[model samples]
Target: MGTCACLRVRGGIRLSRVQHNKGERSTLMKKYLATACALCMGLGVAQASQITVINSEAASFVGVNSNESLGDPSNVVMNWTFTGGFNANNVHISGNLTEVLTGTFASEADIFATLPSGTLDIDQSSTGNYTGTVAVSTDVSIATPVDPAGNVSFEFYESFNDGAGTDQIWDDITIEFQEIGIQNGMVNLGALPSDGSLVTYSGHNVAGGLDFFDFSIGGPGVGAAGSYLNAQTIDPVTGDTIDTEIGLFDSAGVLVAFDDDGQDFALGGLYSMLSFGVDDPLTGSDTTPGADGATLAAGDYTLVVGGYDTNFEDLTIGVSTLADVIAGTSAGDYDLQLSYVPEPASLMLLGFVGMLGLRRRR
Candidate 1:
């Protein structure tokens, strides 16, 4: 009978031990759940804040050039359609520099907004890849000569390039233009801007944040006898410089490639490509800060093309106008690769729960 009583007492002690172990396991499980929630929350925030690059459409008033108005095959238009992608598909940007007369403020002003209306949009399919297109209509206009008995003529030359930046590399540079078509309204005007006449030329100047510039025009402003200059007037007419500057469509009627040391576009100079120094907001300087050079990341950007990194004193406007757009149009998109690395808290909770499981099994 005593042995039976001792066995019962021992069984009660074992039962108490098991119950105590179960309580500890429950506490460990709660901790494990909390840790998991925290980890998931952090991951969610990280993913939500990721950055992306997109394509866009934009325009600017770079400068101007004048040509004697000529008939088709000589007097020409260059409607541009820019298309391309970056390595690893990080940036997707494109647009058409077409001859559209929709002169809204943002549309006319040298601004880069978003895609469709803003210039570009990023590929949201995946944070790493992007793609899009822009259509720019480029047409030259031949003004009726002041001399009723005279004709007008003009021609265009365009080019493209990838601007400067660290994480950005532009490749597969393909510039496509629509082949001139014969319409019913086509005129065979000849011997343009007959001597003793005045023609007016105007257009926009565009550039990427990477110090790259592209020039375009609509009206063949000047006849062969005249000249033009794409310039920047910092003080506006006073022609002085301060923190503020603006582009000028110099159809001043001078045929020289440059004036007062002003830069000039070569013959067939529609797509004038050049690099310029971007003023550094941080240091208030034009030179880049690092060897790779200070670069623009994925954000809104206003890029100008005038002067050089080492030659600021000259103040030569590289192209006619400056074009601004989003950094995504150049940088592509932002994506961070992540892996599941067990956290210390998670490990501790798992360990405790595992131990409880073992205890329950026992």
Candidate 2:
């Protein structure tokens, strides 16, 4: 009888231990499943928040130099068919023109005296119709002295010398979204690892009217609209400072923000510096505190760098504080560093992930 009772007790203990082990395994599986579901949910939220460019289009504005004293500006109509419904708020339009000297000029002075200038005015309709008027001014400078033999190639920015007797003929014109991003035609800076990554790139504003660079902001910085960017121009060869101006455009090719001198005092020089999505409270200040600036939505963006006052020609060559480089002028080896910002949404996701990890530990 005693032997039988001992046998029964041993069997009961073994059965109890087996049941406890199975219960532990079930609890572990439940916890793992909960964590996995949370991760997937977070990822879904992130993916839904992303905004991307679904369609793009291009058009050319051709100029004809009639036998008249001044050439005529060409009006080009641009059309876009969006596979996905068009977002008027997100639509951006930008263009660039290459100067092709059809015939030789008489003299160098005559080159500037009769320098060709063109205007590309973008008019957008509520129905997504885009009309551009490219009018070349009449050559009033024809009376100016000329050699009629000398020819020169000059680099000028867009919208230079609007009212003067300068006429422009734009060939190979292209209009589209931020198609000028790094891979398309802008300078490439490689992959950006994180926020505050100081990436340096160099390029020249020569025959190409503008220099554009593409950079990405990922991780926790993907959705923060309050992030700001800082760009400063440095001489690549001598490291001597060069006056640089920077503009930020969204993937849609819209000019979101611009800055001329945002970092003068900190660098203690006149080299160009600009901030995007960041506010500059200090009047006449060159540096903008990243915290107090304009807000930029997280996504791909194009950075356009040019000589100071090299963008538009409202100011004169010598009168305005604009850079001296004008049409037919080329600046090379300009260096700049881009400061990045993280998105606010990324931070929230990170926090949620951390919480999941803690729960799993418990």
Candidate 3:
């Protein structure tokens, strides 16, 4: 071959080798990007499918019971269907108190729930915070229950009010629940108050306004005292961790109110508790104040409670789980509100990406 032609051929071989090396590096980069995308997708799916044990419904109740409680239709019922995935096996549903009806006391009431054979814990808080017992049946299902999980049926009942004349009603009730948090369960709820913000009660010159406090289902199996949680602190203005009342609600929209005088929370299920206790005291000692005890759980929800006047109007308090906070399901339209405190890492990540792009342009 001519010398010039042979040199040209050698140059062509060198060029082809360079092209091959470039192609290999490009393929390697594509693989790395694909892996990162898959990882991000996996994390999103985990967060999307995560399960929340407690769910509260709306409140809807009509008349008041004769004994001075809310009233007859005050009884509310909500159903919680479990689909065997939660690692923990226990569950708890609690309600708030609004106003106790007072008059002729023909009967008394409480929350009734049927579970798939596990322990039951009933906590009651009024003027004095108290936790009590629940009534359970002696059925086989109640004895040896199945794992993976099952469903629970619950209802709230209260005494009837017969007006011998002095019939009165109470107000302020709220409801919430406690259950397991799982599937890569290492949840560092971190500084919740920092993320979402707490409402502070200012001066206690008067006994009314927004009270922020939380009740959660936890005692065993859950992460910490704060896990499966709800919490609230007195407004710093008041600065007196002095006792106060709160409200509770259920999916059906039943209201329950808590009282500091009696130290218990009472309200009918199926109605959102409007207000419970009066600035003034009840008249007769024999008169019955309205208080129907109950527990609850159903689906997506929002809870609100406060004094009738405006200064305390803006203060709405309650802690919620993803289940309670996020409305809607894998399907349908729902309103959800998520509050979080800002984190330094998130800000740093954004700044770093912006700087990298600026450097590339230069």
Candidate 4:
């Protein structure tokens, strides 16, 4: 009887050791799982949304000198050669002239010459190089009389001749020219928005008559549907919202989506809105595959903003005001707001991680 009792006690000790070891192994497994989940949550949290704004401004000038006889019937041609490439779609050429009329004439009648006027003509080459000529001529008669001293010296005179007593005519004319060009605007989106993310950017459409914003989505999983893009005109001075239109282009320069009226019905049915990866949130409409309907993908894209109904074909010269955009006029001052929204899957993963963390704590 004593031997049997000792054997039972030894069995009990072995069973207790096995149970303790099993409990320790279970705790270690739970810890390993918890660490792996925490790592995934950390990675998700690290992936935040990003945005960028970009623009360009450039200008150049030229100078010219020429001589014209007061009685000469021919126009003065001032040639201009661009020192640098005129890469902008729209180029503005302006000039200032100083004339030194230094010739002697016989009488007041000889002083009655035509005043000088000028015009500009530009030729743009296929390579974006600009070569232009400015023509100046005296179209109308000058009414200034010769001095009693038989000498004519008039500062800031449009047309002048040496006094009638002398044989003096116009000479030594100088002209200064300035040119401005607007290259299209460009921005690159290197990082895409994750789920539950919102990105925003602000820009001005004043430099080029037409504003073209090119954005490239480079990172992975960017074009998944359920993303949103929006653009509107906010008053730079008053901070008031104005009416506008927005359009999107794919990597191949194909029109993908366009919006003239946004979902904000409270603003008299004006504003612009667009969606990615889903149907129209406001109209409950399924997006078509290409025409104003598409899922954004990781690729090059473009955004065009302008006055309502502004002809996009001639974006080289965009309209200037919301009224002009509405009327289809010129390009004007505008403050733009652009944004992006993330996909639903990204949000779901984040939520699931949060719940898991809460449950583990409990």
Best by TM-score: 4
Model 2 worst lDDT run, 10 consecutive residues: 9-18
Q: State the number of backbone clashes in model 1.
A: 56
- Full ranking by TM-score: 4, 2, 3, 1
Q: How many residue pairs clash in each candidate?
A: 56, 25, 88, 24
Question: Tens digit of lDDT per residue, candidate 4, span 63-173?
Answer: 322223343433233223323322222222223233223331111111211112212122211111112222222212113321111121112111323333222222332
Error of 2 at 330 (Å): 6.5
Model 3: number of backbone collisions: 88
Q: Which candidate is the best by lDDT?
A: 2
Ranking of models by lDDT: 2, 4, 3, 1
Q: Model 1 TM-score?
A: 0.14
Local error of candidate 1 at residue 237 (angstroms): 67
Which model, 3 or 4, shows the larger TM-score? 4
Off by over 4 Å in 4: 1-157, 160-174, 178-181, 195-198, 206-208, 216-243, 263-271, 277-295, 312-328, 350-362
Candidate 1 residues 189-234, lDDT tens each? 1111211111111111111122211122222222111222122211
TM-score of 3: 0.21
Model 1, residue 250: displacement in angstroms? 58
Q: How high is the CA lDDT of each candidate model?
A: 0.21, 0.39, 0.28, 0.36
